[model samples]
Target: MRKALTLIGTGLAAALALTACGGSDSTPSADATLDPANPTTITVGATPVPQGRILEFVDENLAKDAGIDLDIKEFTDYQTPNIALSDGSLDANYFQHLAFFDQQVADKGYDFEHGEGIHIEPYAGFSSKHQSVDDIPEGATVAVTNDPGNQPRALKMLEAEGLLAGIEDDSAALTLTDEQNPKGLKFEENQPEILVQLIDDPKVDLAIINGNFILDAGLNTDDAVIVESAENNPYANFLAWKAGDDNPAIAKLEELLHSPDVKKFIEETWPNGDVFPAF
Candidate 1:
């Protein structure tokens, strides 16, 4: 059984920072001293769907008693969260999976550290016109995300469905070569959020959408023509913070996130397996 927590109103002031990541006007400074006995607020940025929703759950049910307060902020794009975290506009963030995080660290040189997987939102190919993968005709138009981290996953899924080949690795530059695209399928690359809109476009036959956008669009995984398997899925989203910033409140929040209560909440909330607990 999960223990219920008592809410505490600290009234401890949060400091102001310039809007670096399109988030709050004021964020708790990373340099402020945090007392373990009193509740501390940590501003975090996340995508609105499962990531923000999960943090909301922690804030509502778990944070108070554990001496932490989560000031959750929602972001639609993937880049801003890390940008905010690096710029000190946010204390931490919870959105990207390991692959995306690694790529961002490599490209942007963000000194970030992440926790174990909290949950996996499996990548799925959704189509409005085609009922199934078999129904996709020759010379079809497929819409996929243009981001380096996820484009490869979309390509790999296409390869798995026998639609494309010669995907040597998870590379963003990967494209359908002469022999790879046997059916002569056309590819339209766009941002992950934009791919959701392309699903209903008359010109697009299929759109491989990111999991969060799929949920934000209120579409079910059951509607996907081709869905990535959750088993051994490497794309589990987790909490992240800047390296060498050992804020105890951040540690408390991370622990509460992996607690059994969170696991149960995920199971009950997304019962259809739209979201799977990685722990």
Candidate 2:
């Protein structure tokens, strides 16, 4: 009886050992098709306005379909996104246009490149107290963006409305001096984001606001007194990354950006044709 009991115990121990060995061996090998070290994690930096919202949509719908994991970082200021991307803290960014990106590269010497063209948010002139551009009296105080990239944009829009004249050479790099204004309109240069606030001030007859800041200020594009024409505007937004990092993730992102899903979203979300899709 003692011998039989000892034999039974030994057999049980052997079976347990086999079970342990099988468990270890059966653990799924890191998907051989996928790079074991390179996970699907990607970090994108964006502004809290439409750019951020667009990325959020991609993270929710597109990333999963592509078998990628997207992490979004929101930035309130314009400069931080490029800085983060340059430092490798972010995989990509989506808040700036080509002109702005070029300016950053030229001024700050950051090595960044653009991915797919996303959308163009047309800048517009809005007035809270006045209903139409015609209502703006002579010598009216008009607020414009003080930034280098957007100041010319504002002036071009103003010139388009016949309030100003001679802007034939308007470009992203063009300044106020490049154009000749005969309307005698008082030009007040301030931050584009603050243009909305200045509208409430009695001195400001009109304010030229960027699309992002316009949305941030809770105003609709259709409500603008005058809007920039998208017909030939070259300052469309883009997805930017470090110069030579063209990885599979960027390719997938570009594909998704140009897909019909994003096109539909841009159409539905920005009805009055304010957001023009580049893809």
Candidate 3:
């Protein structure tokens, strides 16, 4: 389970950073620090869907109570947040998982640390034509995320569903055949973001999707044919900041993110289980 989650984290990280490779080729940022007591505004970077909404909720409803003035910087993709966080443009970021965090920090030589996990965006499989997993026919073309972090989750889910066998390797080298895939399922691989758009494609039988993308697309989890199990899930996203920089404002924001207000908000807002709280 640990190995699979780690692979999924790295997979999503790569997919998120697809347009541009991480570690360099981006502008450098100055170190971002926050004042604990007089946090007029602490800037944070996050992807637009649930992360932005969750942060907005805290900024609007909770930040003021702890004397925190919240400033949210919406990042469309995964590359910019780490770039911004590293150079100090962002006080923190909350769109990535620990596996992605670990891979990026090590590869990019970034000094970063994450707070307790805030939520788990379960990777799931959705089909517009098929009603259920058992209903999937032979020679069906399945689409999976092409990244390392997310691919394992999809593969593991398929494994759990008795579609494929165990995967020893954790790269994009996976292929579907009758030996491991008795159903004769055909597999197509694409970037995590692109898979969402391919959902309605006539050629695609199943689109393995990220939970955030599902929510962002305004689709509910209840519509999915299969969702990766949440028990011991390793893809939980979290708030991350520079290592050794214990900015009080960042700390306060972290605390508020896991507070009852955020929990209640998530519980009520994502009743379909798209964004499961990991706190």
Candidate 4:
């Protein structure tokens, strides 16, 4: 992971219709195909930040040494990578965490599996009205990401802050809770991309946003009331591929991605800790 994230608001999106195939090689036998015996390129779909930048680094610095060529296809949204991968448009993808992977499979029944855990994009609760969780008042209007993969995380943060308790299920929505909700908080759920809008909404007391949104909106990490901790975090992003992962090129790519050099790069590149190594 290299760049923090700039494409979220730039109104530029990579065309998902394009094939996952990529750049040519000097060697006549080499191409952007799954030729395990030859130096072949493996195409991967990713979001521009961190994932796309990471791929770029690997392509320039590591993949050639490993006898694997890297083809990076950038996508703007979370769903398109998996969709392109499943349809054979992409050889692999690296953008989402295991929770999102599970949610995608459970919801859409996609035949996919994540290969290696790479990095963590810390989720955070940002608020314009409240400085701390204790500053929140009763009957407050809170907003959360409505995406299936990230909604529960926002509610779990609220649950930890004493607005509610007894969150037995990660998939369960806050509206379905039967436990005591002491704060009587009102929740507003919206698409993750638009969550930054709620920060200025007069009615919103707390707005929980994911890392990508935080980076896009240029919010201060120090301002978050609560941030997702690194210890045993379940939300580490990984490289995902379709079922029956027997590609030799993919194995090489995984090795390069999880290498010590990448770890050092993440720590040094994002010293303020926008992203951290998960492996």
Give lDDT: candidate 3, residue 258. Answer: 89
Residue-level lDDT tens digits of model 2 in 215-279 = 77778878888899888888788787776664667556656677788888888888887676877
C-alpha RMSD (angstroms) for model 2: 18.3
- Ranking of models by lDDT: 1, 3, 4, 2
Evaluate residue 69 in candidate 4 and report its C-alpha lDDT on the 0 to 100 scale.
Answer: 80
- lDDT per residue, candidate 3, 1-279, as tens digits? 001011123344444432323232111222234333665577888877799889889988887767678677876556667877776777888898866776666566676777778898888888878989998898888998776655767887888888777554363425644566777778898877778888899999899987778878887777888888989988778888776665677777888898988999998988778887897
Residues forming the 10-long window of minimal summed lDDT in candidate 3: 1-10
Question: On a 0 to 1 TM-score scale, where does candidate 2 land against the true structure?
Answer: 0.80
Candidates 1 and 4 compared by lDDT, better number: 1
Residue-level lDDT of model 1, residues 1-279, one tens digit each, is 112222212121122122321121121223335554677988988888898889889889988777788888777788778777887878888888887888777666777888778999988998889898889998999998888877888887888899887775564433557687888888888878889989889999999989999899999999899999876788899888877667878877788889999999999999999998999
Q: After superposition, how far is residue 154 of candidate 1 from its true place, in Å?
A: 0.9
Between which residue pairs do clashes occur in model 1?
Answer: none
Residue-level lDDT for 106 in candidate 4: 72
| Whole-model lDDT per candidate | 0.79, 0.69, 0.74, 0.72
* CA lDDT, candidate 4, residue 278: 87
Error at 85, model 3, angstroms: 1.4
* Residue 255, candidate 3: C-alpha displacement in angstroms: 0.8
Q: Which RMSD does model 3 reach against the true structure?
A: 7.8
Flag clash pairs in model 4.
1-50
Best by TM-score: 1
- For candidate 4, write residues 171-253 as lDDT tens digits: 44546444546667777887777787888788898888878667656775678987877778778888877766567787778
- Evaluated at residue 106, the lDDT of candidate 3 is 59
- Winner on TM-score between 1 and 2 is 1
Instruction: Estimate the overall C-alpha local distance difference test score of candidate 4.
Output: 0.72
